[model samples]
Target chain A: MKIWCDRANNQRVAWHCRSHPETAESNAYAEVFQLQRSFIGTSPVHVPTVADIQVVTRRPADERPAVILLELPNRHLGCQTYPYDDLVQISRLCRAANIRLHLDGARLWEIQPFYNRPFADLARLFDSVYVSLYKGLRGTVGCVLASSDAAFMAEAALWQRRLGGWMVTSYPVLIDCERAFNLNIGTFERKWRKMCAVAAAIVQATKDFTTSDGRPIVYFTPEVPTCCQVHTHIRGVTRERLAAARDEVERDLGLSVFPWTLPSPFMHELDPDWVLVNGDPLAVQGMDQYFEWSITDKNVDIPDAVFAQGWRAIVTVLFA
Target chain B: MKIWCDRANNQRVAWHCRSHPETAESNAYAEVFQLQRSFIGTSPVHVPTVADIQVVTRRPADERPAVILLELPNRHLGCQTYPYDDLVQISRLCRAANIRLHLDGARLWEIQPFYNRPFADLARLFDSVYVSLYKGLRGTVGCVLASSDAAFMAEAALWQRRLGGWMVTSYPVLIDCERAFNLNIGTFERKWRKMCAVAAAIVQATKDFTTSDGRPIVYFTPEVPTCCQVHTHIRGVTRERLAAARDEVERDLGLSVFPWTLPSPFMHELDPDWVLVNGDPLAVQGMDQYFEWSITDKNVDIPDAVFAQGWRAIVTVLFA
Candidate 1:
């Protein structure tokens, strides 16, 4: 089994270098590629970046491909969706190559608000798309795989029957999921904005603050156009704190917020270049204020507290 | 396609005489046979019962079998959960042949209380057991297809994936189904006994009184069996009054109930056999005197009424 990843320019050196304080980007790359090769032969391919897989599928090589996947980019909060421009291009390529495109849309519902596209239009492009009711739809259990009636009828029933998913006698989970999907999904985009703003404030506040472990406070970088950034200092954390953070993030946003603390940033899921934001949006805002106050008292030429406060307020309202 | 029907003996005779009932049973069978010979390219053949489909699969004389289904003997609560005596024999035949066994176990859960067997143990005997979550479980909607995980992973998934069944997210449905499955099951037989006793008293008292429908009443009979003993003349009566009876039954018994009405006695499912006592148990005792007094002369059947009164005192107190 072969794997592929982007060997793009690093940020600290060139414009594209991942702009973080510690743990170089090269090491991140190596760790991710290594973990994925572990599950290379598994049915569900271990991918760290959707773009990485996309890059390979669109490699313009002459070899016949068996199956192609539409996977998520970084599995993180406020993680922007896969590149739509690249996605349509990939679909065209797969169609040209006569290859099957299967979508791993576990986060597909959450993705639409970020990408600014309708699910129906996106759904039409793939030969088959797999979406989990338990994920973005907020079901306790179950998943859906959709495609053309004939082609889908040929394989999915056979697989679900074989996979032990068909034994579920009734669909209470689906009904609950439907309510959550219909009622709560509309506000996701607004919430995403709030998270991004709060994350920006956090990094600005903690510009020089260190944690108990003596590492600089890490914040998410909204990798807008040219660059992407993830925070440093992953270790020296207690299990309690980690769990608390996950719970807080999920509760506040009413959705799961992963990238809580990964062994390596780029492992497990093929991550999209994300505008990393801390799950603790309120705490980030607080940190921003602290930085503004401390720096100004020292007579530093940093941005003013009023500006910081205004930024945080905007972020809070956006998420709210 | 060979079809196994319980009343196929009567059905064949009726069809030959040009006098079959409009029930789905007779019409559905004839249509199914037509489709088998034409659309499905298999000649329609009749079997006495589908206790075994192994016969046709092994001794395929000419045509491929269409669908081997039996007219399962109805208790007319829409359930026919027989003991292992029949099922185990059927399963052995299924295992030796390539034929798929599809259980029309719509109220399969009803069988659980009568014979007392684990659901999985019974499910293991069939290739695919179709269980409706609503019938006995009181779920709002949904059915389950239970089978081997290997079969699910191998064959069933392909069919589910291909069918539009893949489009549905299932968590909500499962939630409701499992909630009903966990909470609403049990006490069926206990309530059933109460209903049978009450019916026995009524049948003994009101020989001249016709039910809302014209059908005559019987306690538990061998042909109509236990579940259909409550058959009344009001089969097509408004659900408003039918529901009132349901509420009354619940009020007296404190258990839930299921109501199944059939077209006619000649239809067999309508044959008065047993009162379906699926609802609250005490409710019937509380309401039995009201029924006995209202339908018969108040002076009649003093001994039977006194006996019923004694039964009500014990059962309701025990239930309480």
Candidate 2:
């Protein structure tokens, strides 16, 4: 993708991206190519608005971005995505402005249930689409990049050879990727439905819950997830405390609640003036522990009540 | 290796290499880095001499090479290696000249039998050593680069991350490599001995043989095997004819003689003034077909007489 980006914007023109600063696109542009990037702002729902994109496109000719990278269901921002009509408008705006639009469809499979649209319909809107086989598709590590532009893809192949990305044998990885895709692709819609039900149960069960410190204990970022993933925030709880509670619940009840948690990026965004200690704002305030709760076919079969009970057990240990 | 070369030779200092232009070092430096390279001439045995090393190191300060890359038992040149004494002198020469020496030990295992030296002892001569896990070890695919220079290895690791060389899970490859090394490392000396005996038998059986065109039918490049590999050149036979003969012999007698053949690089060197037709000299004179006959434990069990018989059948078919 870096190579393709380099080739697409050979003049080193600025790229427009709404993804987080930690994403592969942001890192590659800043660290590898040293290319300028213009970020589109997200609405309250955490999805980039058409107005936000026009703001960058309205800039002077010298400042106009050459390419706009859109991530389907932005993973870092609670896997939020624009409504289908809004996305279509954004795509049209880019085309009218002569800016190439690329899709970082790493989690494209997850959003299919929300849009209820065919993969081709979503992919056709972008000039280039990159999909990860390992993400929602449950494949081994690999990705496929599709582009209508033959020259761009040819340059990508040249770069692949130059960078030693072409392996002598990738048959094993490809075979595993195919097997995983076949096994899990059909289960995503069901998984997404289960995830929403599970989130609703947790929100209902912990409606008025509060920490020992008198702070709201738990809440969902979007209140309703668009995909099989949702970000759950635990106010007045340190990441360490959350992890301990999760481990305790799993050990005692044999129910795993969350794989891991970290200090939420939104905490700093919501409170820009928050004090920091030792380079960590979370050190001064404990109301920011968050984790992305992702439901796969493996756990979708478990009733939503079981998940609510597991979260309740975790919170009990947290406020103990 | 490309990244390490870029980091080490930051000023784009010229490199010294004796390996063929098709080898990784030559291609990376020429095509990737666009760095200047100085070639050290090989002796009749196709091993770079200490005199060749001095010629490059003796250059004026402005033209002195930064690094000298030496391939163990140059795979393209009949798997020939320098006498242990010559290699020691070349290593000392590079050190005295303040030039870093790197070993392209892709075939390092093949040369161990000829040098009769410990792997560590041979590796310690150069500033950095690279060995392929797949070539002779029969592993899947991977290589290890070792160096006492902490900074160089640290830089290599950084490049590995930047280039996406680090896999999500390489445990399977590592496990297979370890298994292959354990199974094959001890049998190299025996394989080398078997390869020499087989080569001698082939030479003896076909010494006076001639093609229908009155040209010599076959000959070994070095006239003796240095390691488990030897380059066998078939005079008066095009690569196409050689391949057909090999396939026919395999089908009829159930004996696989040569896996594949190509016009030997040495042929062009031997007859630089040969007339060319359609960009290939072999089209004008079919006297250059050759292939590297690499002996592994799989073939070492087959008697030398069987191999000699196989070659004889191939040649008879080629003449007919």
Candidate 3:
């Protein structure tokens, strides 16, 4: 029969669905734990929410799921960073239940600064670790899979070949990754701090978008974000105006304010009305519209004056 | 349960083993054809031989296998290319038997001339076609899976992601593929004619390496090669001496004559004794040593004079 390997990232996401009884025909044996949605931008799979991880893990051994997968910074539901203690608890529970735990650390590098731990330490919590080359690092294309089991890795190589993951030459990807690594070392940490402070300041300054009681007009999840990423729930605005604001920022200040509507394919598993605004609010509509914003290298260098001008344009478009 | 997709290539090769009645516990419902070994490289899976493709197809409909997979110009075997008539009968048989046929056209491009048909025509015979970007094209990583079934492609995408085949950015691989395509288009046809003519000339001139009966000291299959790929079995030379000849050709002539011994992972699925000598004789041991060579871009540009010198070195080391 013709067969192929499944993409590792998608595997991490879809594996969770195995536990849902509705999907039993395909994943009948799985004991799935539906965790509260964590951040995983627009990815079709819904990640378990961090709040539910402990409760799910506390299940009896026989009732425990066969595999537990976690994505650091949960880039989809909202850029939520779990505490080390919480991760430790989940890992311990998996161990007790004899379940395999895997990490989809596509943005692990982007979230590393908030954890205050080395990557190796975080990676040690799982049986296997997958790190992407191009996510936030802005490299070409590649991924690194790490595991303590040599046999598993050998099998992985066979699987990689089956999946057409074996490239005759990956020098170009390696070169680009190397270049990105050298240029980006220790940079995410700085960006993480700047993003949180700036997002909070932006929310505070936009008082007109808030309730009269001084409650903010916009709802920013993890209000102070865990890393460079932040999710925003826009209020007092229309989706078209938000989209217009995004265009205004780009046209007026040469900056992109990536805006998305609710129910994106990437976020279809989540609430459909949740719009994602990634790094700067451009344009969006509806009181329930959500978007995401994350500080990236491109905007990291924007002059303070230029950023302020862009912010003005965004606010003007939304309010005007 | 922890589940993963079987690596396609290896699965294609190895799945036949499941058809053996001894393996029926695992594949109780499968109507597997244990045909003779076809070219599957040294993949651990053993493919049915070309001789069995027809015999197996003529089986009762109830006994017909569910899937029939074929590789054009089988790379692991003697680079054999099936005639268009043979493929047509196989396709018609599969249709009659309600079996799904797929082609692993990894080297289909290399053997295009032997069939004298466009890729589309060859591909149309199967339910799906998988073409590698780097094989003879000498590009980077990536492959394209084509099919008339849109649903299958969509499903394949999910499997691709599960296997970590989804890359955030594959531009590096794409760019290299584009470059190779532009530079090498229509080049294979020209090289195919040159390789066959040169190989015949080389075999004719190396008469001294043969016995009085004219059966050469070395064996060449497709002695009239079906494509640019040729297999050789060299007797009468020490493996070390053959290796030295390879080094000398590369050092003195500034040309590489890539030589390899048996037991290479790439050839592991083949007989362990089948040593592959790509161009000229290089590293090999035993009078029964064997190797294979295929004309690729790396050696395609060698001047006729340089190649002649290299050829001389190869003969001298083996026969003198």
Best by DockQ: 2
Give residue B244's error in model 1 in angstroms.
Answer: 29
Q: Which stretches of model 2 miss by more than 4 angstroms?
A: A1-38, A42-47, A59-63, A211-216, A266-287, B1-9, B13-38, B42-47, B60-62, B211-215, B266-286
Residue ranges of candidate 1 with Cα displaced over 4 Å:
A1-63, A73-80, A117-125, A131-178, A210-215, A221-235, A240-320, B1-109, B112-133, B141-187, B190-320
TM-score-based ranking: 2, 3, 1
The TM-score of candidate 2 is: 0.86
* Poorest lDDT segment (10 consecutive residues) of candidate 1 chain A: A7-16
Local accuracy of candidate 3 as per-residue lDDT tens digits, A121-179: 89999888778777678777677887887866876665455433444456788888889
lDDT for B191 (candidate 3): 75
DockQ of all predictions against the true structure, Cα-based: 0.04, 0.28, 0.21
Q: What shift in Å separates residue B155 of candidate 1 from its native position after superposition?
A: 19
Every model's TM-score on chain B: 0.52, 0.86, 0.73
**Residue A103 of model 3, lDDT score:** 78
lDDT of 2 at A130: 83
lDDT, candidate 3, B214-242, per-residue tens: 66765566677777776665555556776
lDDT of each: 0.41, 0.72, 0.59
**TM-score for candidate 1:** 0.42
**lDDT of prediction 1:** 0.41
